[model samples]
Target: MNQLPKESIIKLQSHINKEVVIQFQGGRQVKGTLLSFDNQLNLVLDEVRELPSQRILGLVICRGALINSFAIDGMVEIENPYI
Candidate 1:
């Protein structure tokens, strides 16, 4: 079984229980509180809501393959190792 890199795990761990915005393929997006995630980047989120419309979705398990990107609800400055 391939394991996730330590840095990735640490980054995700910091976001647990925090509000996040997940953008999916085809431009769909949602906001929710991150509950859990796996090596594949698949996520379990609570209090999920669709973006723009703000429709309540309650809870969701999102497949990593469909995910385009993830953003914390607020500004987060990631250190740039090369800079």
Candidate 2:
């Protein structure tokens, strides 16, 4: 199994329990609180809701292979490395 990069793990750790938006293959999107994640990129989310339609899905476990992309909800300020 391919291991997650250290930077990616740190970023995910920072987003734990925060709201996130996940886009799955075939163009489905969901919004929820990030509960946990694994090196495979598999995720466990709570209070999930389908995007656009706002249908509630409660808790969900998303397969890493099916995830297209994901972004943390709202603005996140990154420390400027060049500062």
* Candidate number of the best lDDT: 1
Model 2: how far is 48 from its true place, Å?
A: 0.2
Candidate 2 residue-wise lDDT, 1-83, digit = tens: 99965645345888899999998999999999999998888899999999989999999999999998788755466899998
Residues 1-83 of candidate 1 have per-residue lDDT tens digits of 99965555336988899999999999999999999999888999999999989999999999998998899865476899998
Worst 10 residues of 2 by lDDT: 4-13
Candidate 2: where is the Cα deviation over 4 Å? 1-10, 74-83
Query: Can you give the TM-score per candidate against the true fold?
Result: 0.77, 0.76
lDDT values of the candidates? 0.90, 0.88
Structure candidate 2, residue pairs in collision: none
Off by over 4 Å in 1: 1-10, 74-83
